[model samples]
Target: MSSKVPIFTLSNGVRMPSVGLGTWQMTGDEGKTVIRNAILAGYRHIDTATLYQNEDQIGDALAELFAEGVVKRDDLFITTKAFCHEVAPDVIEEALRNSLKRLRLDYVDLYLAHIPAATRECGSHRTDVKVEDIWKGLEKLYSLGLTKSIGVSNFNESQIERIVKIQKVPIHVSQLELHLYLPQKAHREICKKHSIIITAYATLGSPGRMSVIGADGKPLFESTKNIPNELNDKNVKALAQKYNKTPVQILLRATVDMGIVVIPKTTNPERMKENINLFDFSISKAEVNLLEAHERSKPERLFWWPNVSEHPEDPFAAER
Candidate 1:
């Protein structure tokens, strides 16, 4: 099987794979095996975070691949984030070093401020930190060559603007939980204006996972009984039939066609292969619009992290 995935050049001239393997809720031998298989199946990008607690396993997988001559160190694009608690300016470099140690790498392709808000060790939101302060640390990392690019995640337009105003280097990327249900057009427009690439997580939404719960201790979805599954939506199904592709493929292709990078996590090797095979087909403009229209009138973010919603810098705040 050919192990080739399409690449998109970042504003900083770094080449990033259009689709990456996400290592969230995965670790140990299982995480290593899945990451290895993903690379063998043509995934050149791997997204992880210190918060995920799987950097060591991912590192082992990369080590094995290099030792076996399956791929070179420079052949992959690795991305990890600074946990919310580590976003403090004083601790940024130290946190990055810890992540690097775990991933067994000297430098990362990209390093992101995992979340806009800062939190205490006990996981309570800290009101003292500002997004700009954390961004200054990222700038330091960029200048030191520890990370080729630095950016933010789950940040709103105002928060991004705050960083951009004080930024010496361009924000290279802005990762968000983007999908058919939450296209985040406003944020996408902001990123486009600044030439910041958007790396979409949760692209497939809650495919097979248990229903998410909100801050109110209530199910996010009232009932799977009456609501239609996005993957099984009539519109998505119709497009799948038209393209002679699976519903998942149609959904992923739609995101790629929009020039957005998507990372869909799955431990299943077969699903991993299927997720990266998006380069073979193109979704037409009309079909693309049909998929885009699937976006909800009001976004229903699956990972709002309500505990931080009251934080001043909370991107999910009503004012934002």
Candidate 2:
């Protein structure tokens, strides 16, 4: 296998590994093992969020590694996000401090405003927080040096532009649901204009998750007539077979080629190693052209889109 890709430097001068282990569904002991193994496997970046409820497990693993002198705290790039309805200055500060406490770290490498919500509804978890107010609080955190870098998740072009205009500092990253099925191309242009790096989640189309608008609960990437549909387009599968790689690896290479960071969340050790093994291969221009041709195929949104009618903060409402 080729040498692992070096970490990417953020717009703020903070270096973050382009590939990392995402800890979304992982929980309890399973969460710790996934993180520790990923670290031992040579992953320096780890993605986590308060909503995951596994911060304490990550903390324990990091503590254990530190005690064993396996890795120094500065060597690892840790990222965590704070959800909407916690954008109040005090609440945001408290949430961040709590994250630091749970992760057993002095500060996080990167902290994101998980979702944009309104200030009045922040403490009540009302899910109506405004994006600008949240940006204000994030800027505060950046100024305080409590977070090495500050950014957003699930933000669109317009939302990102507004934040850039008002931010006291530049945004270093914007995490979004980007995959073979749903590539947010237009918004990516806006991010590029602001020098904001895009980090993709659900990089595999999240095959195991439920569809957002389907009542029958169709899988995000269902196959038809022995051919994979959605993100697993015949072309993608063909490329995967040609390279002796999984469709997931193809999707990841495509995103990485676009200069976007990918984090495919999985607790399975083999899969974790498989997901990060892409540095050894490179996709050709012709292959990327074939994948682009299928880009207009039906797009799928996997995660929750709660009360879209009521929540303007909802990212799913943003145009793809």
List, residue by residue over 176-241, the lDDT tens digit for candidate 1.
988887788999999999999999987887553444455678765544334345687788899889
Worst 10 residues of 2 by lDDT: 220-229
Per-residue lDDT of model 2, residues 1-320, tens digit only: 01395567899889888888888778899999888888887788899998789999999999999999988988888999986546655579888989999999998989998876543432334443567778888888888888999989877677888877777888899999876657777878888888888999887766545322244576533432222334557888888899998888888888788888887788788888888888678899888867866655656555543423246666656442
How far residue 199's Cα lies from its native spot in candidate 2, in Å, is: 0.3
The estimated TM-scores of all candidates read: 0.93, 0.88
Evaluate model 2: give its lDDT: 0.78
| Candidate 2 error regions (>4 Å) | 1-3, 118-129, 210-231, 307-309, 318-320
lDDT of each: 0.85, 0.78
What are the root-mean-square deviations of the candidates from the true structure over C-alphas?
Answer: 2.7, 3.9
Candidate of highest lDDT: 1
